[model samples]
Target: MMTTAAPFRPGDATPTATIRTRFPALRREHRGRPVAYFDGPGGTQVPELVARAVADYLIHHNANTHWRYPTSEETDRLLAQAREAVADLLGAEPGEIVFGANMTTLAFHLGRALGRRWGPGDELVVTELDHHANVAPWRALERERGVTVRSVPLDLETGELDWAALEAALSPRTRLLAIGAASNALGTVSDVGRACALARAAGALSFVDAVHYAPHAVVDVRAIGCDFLACSAYKFYGPHVGVLYGRRDRVEALDAPKLAPAPETAPERLETGTLNHEGIVGAAAAVEFLASLAGGAGGPRRERLGRTFAALHERGQALVQRLWDGLGGIRGVTRYGPPPGRPRTPTVSFTVAGRSSDKVAVALADEAVFVSNGDFYATTVVERLGLASEGLVRAGCACYTTEEEVDRLIEAVGRVAPT
Candidate 1:
């Protein structure tokens, strides 16, 4: 169904010096060689610490919470620590964080619970640029709650959100505004602060999916002023886990469907049943690993966490810029989002004319460079761009990505381009 693009080789060069001094898990061997992962939008490879924590949680503390036994108490304590870690990352109260299988599950649960409050003619705005994790749940909510779903359009040519269009979509009845921190399809980081402001002015709850953006950008729910935000730890070098950060008041206000008998926790109410405790522990470990990579704070716990997040932002921006520059110079390639030298994070999406995206992905894989080649669950954006049927290649970067990896991917892209 597709033709392969040209082939390119990754020439040998001394790797970037500014590499992670740690991350043995990421430096994993495949066929006796170091692996390179540019498919961060899909999932990030975790660090050894994260893996160790997961294994440790399972082997050493294999018990549920709240039991009178020592193991159960320990499990509860570890989880409490994890909640605090997540809260520190989002700059929110630990009680404000909710755990679930992944972002989609949390969004669906939150959407449905919040949907109970909506009625006919009420409105919600979902951006075309968001992954379905953020879009579908709201749409289901609209159908169930008699609310109207409004879609914010985009400038397809540049893969940028049409801010004016988004403003027009807002109204007094907009009960919720669903947006993504970054486009998993186009790598376009939305103006979450601006969107949140508009939603607040309309008295609507603003929920953002930072899943794709988390590895490449910094997230602070307080800074964005969002009512709720969800992201997957797996997308940021942890286990396959989802985390939700809710404004303390907003989370407390919503009565998510749960075992009513269960004690009311801002997060626990929404968390519902027993969860993947091991994964939660792993997620916390991943955050710790990233915080170390983030630098600027080898000091206090909370202060170091904040410093680490900011540092990731700076480093991610630099790596992404190099990736953009490398991809921009290639012929027949049309890039999406923030252009080559913009302040956007390191995830880059683009299409090679005349070659199907699936084929392009394979071509790159042949050169040992991995990338995603589909709607990437960012259905709305693709449908809006009329590329729903023909997705593009997405080569994203995480905190651990190196300049050599970027160069190898760029060179591979040039090879994958079919004439």
Candidate 2:
């Protein structure tokens, strides 16, 4: 009786077009070459669907929400659509989804709100694998509110979160645990399910940063049982925006220092001032773009999620494995995270032994291969691995990336490896 699930095929036309079709800008070639985007960890290249949604919002529904005019009513409708779309994307309730400018700002806002609850002697358990956005807030709380910020070390060899360190770090005084669902630098997907359970047992709330994880796979906050989750739209092939999901009760109870006239709603209260109606509308379209990749609909919720994600996952694993194997075969590339054919996203970071990360980035750029270099805002990881001064070069793949693209990158990296 389920009508939402869609059967997935390896090479369905609809999904293939959704994966390959690009807007004019995204398809624009510089010097007669397509820009191969391996910078997905930072953000994704938007499709025509998302671009059209943004334009449609600005042209047709330009007014702010809840106003009296027709434009305002349309804007309100768009807002509702945005909420529903984002909620469905993360398997959350519409009332639980809150909009923000970006994940870093949202995390800070949420942290400040949560920080109010913890005073002197209260502790926050954080990982060395998290971005500075997740680290600095708790450290600030420690300095200002007399709380203790404890660091949970990582297993550098495996590029994984150290559970023993995390378990021992938590105590009755622990108030929070901020962990990334996947390492932005290393692409090591952590066990948020276990982390959430541990947080609950330790009488603490868990915040999961899914900004990196959202694009590669499906996110079910309820399944993971985390307290707060944040991810960016740009990272997921949408416009530049962020989504924050909070349990209704917890969001309602946050003593956020907001305007006197702020709406007393679970989501609206946390949303603060005016939102990016256009970006949000575009985010809805982005979700549509992803769902469209699920083939046609006629199955159960679990079945649908499973079907679509299986295709995406297989594609991702293949591309990642190809890149890993290709890089490994060549000399001087010390790649991080799970090995080739491992259960991880296709985001890879590595050092050239003889070449600087900046040099590798520059060499790739010359060939119209766009990749990133440096910590990627995952400051704690870079510092932990002595890659802070000059970060490891990163070449990340998306659902849109092809086998041909990975081969090109490997060939280019090999040629540029200090030869």
Candidate 3:
């Protein structure tokens, strides 16, 4: 008999009181009021442990890789450990993790490498819901390599992808399918595993942008069955660093542009120049920080991460439900995206009538309730929604977020919402 897994309860993970102590940013006061950070989707506040990890690496073991010196060897070892940490986080092999400046840079580099294998007759598929970071790279190939780019339309009403349009976009000539695991703006979660399977059936490779999704949900690259995936460390409370996970064979066979003296290995070949050694160390620490949230949970780091994410997902759903209902009750406040009880993250976006997005954001800032405004690099989504001029006011919940803070945000927005 098939049985459903039990839902994660608050007791399964660490308490918010303990979690709040790890982030110093939560203590900051703005205009005599405690700041409520609803800007997690743009980037999360860093924990003390992650900062200490970066500082420790910089102060003591900072050195270039592969020299015979102690610091160099330590640097090499620490980098390897970081890879292992990220591997556990994403359910991939350590060697498959490639470090870079950010997700956008990594995507551009990968696009160029993959583009070299395609020509006039080749086609690439992307989605309207994707951040331009995912779309721009592949689109660049159209100008540089004469490839056709097809975009799957988003269902505005449901805030989901049009499966029929996605199927129509794929064919034998399609070389790659670039998509996002979650929408950073509206928080809509896509069924990427099914999308990847479709790409495979159409004889195409799949690339998933998980920058926004990784912080909210557990990412299992193997289960997703994507050839490549990219995420940023800063988005997940680490220092500004990007990670790219490519399948072993695909990475080994990549025709990436590099110097002859650079290490000609699967991952190192994909990396260019000296990496942010400190940032990479902190990235791994961020992963550990997440796993640590599982409290006394036993077994491997990956299993602990699974528990932690389950609990976080439960908390996020509760927050989204409250946020959605509160905002819906406010007059002239129109929310965009899937309602609660659907596939989505804790992030929510909306616009208040008679108020521009920037104006609303500034008003929230006055109340020390932080939020992000603008298209958030998902320009196409805003353009499609016909809010290109005013943009969107986005609020996101994180591990550190509390019910009090959510209520404060809703209250603050309600104050400025048109009557």
Please give each candidate's TM-score: 0.91, 0.95, 0.98
- The local distance difference test score of model 1 is 0.80
Give the best candidate by lDDT. Answer: 3
* Residue-wise C-alpha lDDT for candidate 1, range 1-419, written one tens digit per residue: 99773332111111224334446655565555456777888987777788899999999999988999989999999999999888877777889989899999999999988988888989999977778888899889766877899988778766778899999999998898999888887777778998999999998899988887777655778889999999999988899989999887788888688887887867788887898999999989877876665343255555555555565666567777887788888888877777755446677888888888898888877666778888888776777766777787888877677778888888888886765
Candidate 2 on 53-117: residue-level lDDT in tens? 99988987799878799999999888888888888888999999999999888988988888888
Best by TM-score: 3
* lDDT (C-alpha) at residue 223 in model 1: 84
Candidate 1, superposed: residue stretches over 4 Å from native: 1-21, 25-33
- Residue 262, candidate 2: Cα error in Å is 1.1
Local distance difference test, each candidate: 0.80, 0.84, 0.95
Model 2 scores what on Cα lDDT? 0.84
What order do candidates take by lDDT, descending? Answer: 3, 2, 1
- Looking at model 3, the pairs that clash are none
**Candidate structures ordered by TM-score, highest first:** 3, 2, 1
Stretches > 4 Å off in candidate 3: 1-10
Residue 283, model 1, lDDT: 88
lDDT of 3 by residue, 1-419 (tens): 99875655657799888999999999999999999999999999999999999999999999999999999999999999999999999999999999999999999999999999999999999999999999999999999999999999999999999999999999999999999999998899999999999999999999999999999999999999999999999999899999999998999888999999998888899999999999999999999999999877466999989999988999999999999999999999999999999999999999999999999999999999999999999999999999999999999999999999989988988999866
